[model samples]
Target: MPHTIRVLVAKPGLDGHDRGAKIIARALRDAGMEVIYTGLQQTPSMIVEAAIQEDVDVIGLSILSGAHLTLLPHVTRLLAQERAEDILVIAGGIIPPADAQLLKEQHGIAEVFTPGSPMSEIVRYIEEHVRSAKDLELPATA
Candidate 1:
């Protein structure tokens, strides 16, 4: 059986702008992926905890409040520490290309969708990355 792609859409820190997050959630659901929408004003810890509980394969963060530099890294660090490095982390909202590059280089962010990115594009990215992640597997330690 094909694994259902589970994703957590989170709004980190004081960012209350969730319209984009909700829309993306709907789109992902339409694409047959299970999505957990964490609503607005989430802390990095809360997002990580929810992702862990949900056992999601991807975490999509929407931070338009210019806190991406701080919040994105924090989430990445937590995921890495938890041995959940396989989870694909992507972000959207108000991110510059330079910062996006920094995110990918420093934090292993799979992709960053900027404003006006089509829904289909985002959906395709999730599908592709999820497949890629599934292809590379390592056995757990004793």
Candidate 2:
């Protein structure tokens, strides 16, 4: 059997809001992907550790505390340090376009979903971009 795509949805910093994160996690689950949500006030290290533990294919960060510029890069850096940079990173919630660009260009975030983005779009993006572990393996030889 093929491996399922696993995702880690995190809320970093002091962001008390998690309705959007919960919604995205539910949507991903509905789309047949396994989602691990790292509830409120998670640190960068905590997020990366959870991703490693969960063996996630993607890390979806939701930051409404206007700390995307700081927290996003921190998570990316921690992932790099853990050599888990291969995991795709995506962000959402209250991020401005300029910061989104920085996230993509500087921090290597795969995508950013601002408010008003359709849940279908987020689901589709993950389906299209994240490669499952089974997909990366070579077939057995005869």
- Give the top-scoring candidate (TM-score): 1
Q: What is the lDDT of residue 24 in candidate 2?
A: 93
lDDT of 1 by residue, 1-142 (tens): 5677899999999987789899999998888888999999999889999999999999999989998999999999999888888889999999999999999998888899999999989988888888887973322212
Q: Which sections of candidate 1 miss by over 4 Å?
A: 136-142
Error of 1 at 38 (Å): 0.6
lDDT of 2 by residue, 1-142 (tens): 5457789999999999999999999998888888999899999999999999989999999999998999999999999998998899999999889889989999979899998999889987887676453355322212
The RMSD of every model to the true structure, in order and in angstroms, is 5.7, 4.6
Output the worst ten-in-a-row residue range by lDDT, candidate 2.
Answer: 133-142
Model 1 accuracy (lDDT, Cα): 0.89
- Enumerate residue pairs that collide in model 2: none
TM-score of 2: 0.91
lDDT of each: 0.89, 0.88
